[model samples]
Target: MPNRLRRAVAGLIAAVLLTASATTATTANAAPSSGFDNWSCKPSAAHPNPLVLLHGLGGNGPGNYSFLGPFLAAKGYCAFTLAYGQATPAIPVGGTVSIAQSSAEIQAFVQQVRQATGAAKVDIVGHSEGGFQSIYGPKVRGYAGQVGKVVALAPPTHGTEFGGLVSVGDYLGLRPLVDQVLQQFGCPACDELIVGGAAVAKLTTGPIAQPGVAYTVIASRFDALVTPHETSFIREPGVTNKYVQDTCPLDPVGHVGLAFDPTVAQLVANALDPAHASRVVCAFGPPL
Candidate 1:
């Protein structure tokens, strides 16, 4: 199946899982469950900077981050997630808009989080396309000095092959058709993920990481979405690039699983606060 269809299928799965696993308390305040979207919460000394969660393509804030929000809050960190790239609110999928537009949304959200928490800066934790926003928003576009650290989970920093389908499409001269079909899903970001797409060409041509902002990319060798896997790796001098398999050899987590994996969550915690990093345990389970 094409990547577009696969994404639609993923959206269905997210909807089902969201409904099945929801608690009454969280469901009652579904807009911002698990300490997310809470304007009243202030940043604590132990966690001076608030953490923002960016979801992947075809994923909304609550659906993508229901697990990570509470996880970070338990660590005394103020976490927040917002819905962006929504060309159709009736459809409800997020991160479907162009990267440039999404970057603007991130900028606005970062400011809002900063004003609400009374913090000078915010740390970003993004998954998939969200990872791109975490970097582009702070480094290239908005949020300039307001961003401190960024942790990208299974990000296609360079680009992907649609799980090797891009090569097939290119060989058959179906690249444009494929891109068009994916874009029809109400997500222009999908077109940007194409191998030689304009977005990929532009992002890779410049310095991906900016000065004064710490960067970490946690990728999976087994990730099926980010083809070649190396696309997710950052070769910059100062960036800390981690392979999930290296941290836990038994981990079979794929692209989507990176967000749901508990081990990856622990890794995120470690990245957020390296000074007081927790000892990560090796375990096996579905991202749920």
Candidate 2:
């Protein structure tokens, strides 16, 4: 890379890191979302398995699922959330570490949830990075048997170009430099999310959906982060993929808002319990 370009990229990375650090500092102490982490709540007969809610990159368990967690719990499901993949004590936001490490944390949490609820399996509702881990934990991290259903919202199952910045970097052969800079700042997962990065390549090597595990992928056309949005869908035989606009044409929800969107919560409810599925009620607004 040219010296000038290198300097520019370094400045951009530093700005992003500083912004992330500021955001985490502000929201790190936020309380857990309502209706989650209820260790004493057991799975009922209708909802046979407890539900695990996973948050996205740069998000904590409480802030991400503030709406969805309570919605599911009100529907008679035992929903739980955890803050995983904390890259450093200084940054309390989750999903900043490598996917492998985060998936291992998920495995341990799943065991704890199963033991607490006495259920054979648990269902997953993940958003963004959490959505990727929903499948990664089962396919790569050996949590398949413990997971029954997975509902992914706005997940970059394939990968993202970060609004074409990643492609630009790859073309300039600056990806390695970018990755190094991000890792030094304790955000290795940021590089791993780039299109054609090592982690995404590993996920694409084999079938994304595991057998005997029900999968549902929900995306939004308005999502700016996961460009083209269709990359969030799984083209497997049994997996169900949907777009929010398919039902609510003008909902205008974005990537981060998907977890807090009522329309998405309804979609998740139907995915988790198809036997009693109902029509989705759409509303217009940003995330709550």
RMSD for each of the candidates: 6.4, 8.7
Instruction: After superposing candidate 1 on the true structure, give the runs of residues whose Cα lies further than 4 Å from its correct spot.
Output: 1-34, 163-186, 285-288
Error of 1 at 23 (Å): 7.8
Candidate 2 residue 23 Cα shift, in angstroms, is 25
lDDT of 1: 0.72
- Model 2: per-residue Cα lDDT over 1-288, one tens digit each: 477755764454444345434544433333322135566777778888899988887666765665677667767777888888875555446777788888889989999999988899999998888998897788988778888999998778888867322221222233554344345665677678778876788888889899889999999888878877888898998799999889999897767667656788898999999999999889743421
Estimate TM-scores for all models: 0.82, 0.80
Which clashing pairs does model 2 show? Answer: none
Question: Per-residue lDDT for 105 in model 1?
Answer: 85
Question: 96-122 in candidate 1: lDDT tens per residue?
Answer: 678888888888898898888788999
- Model 2 has how many clashing residue pairs? 0
Clashing pairs in 1: none
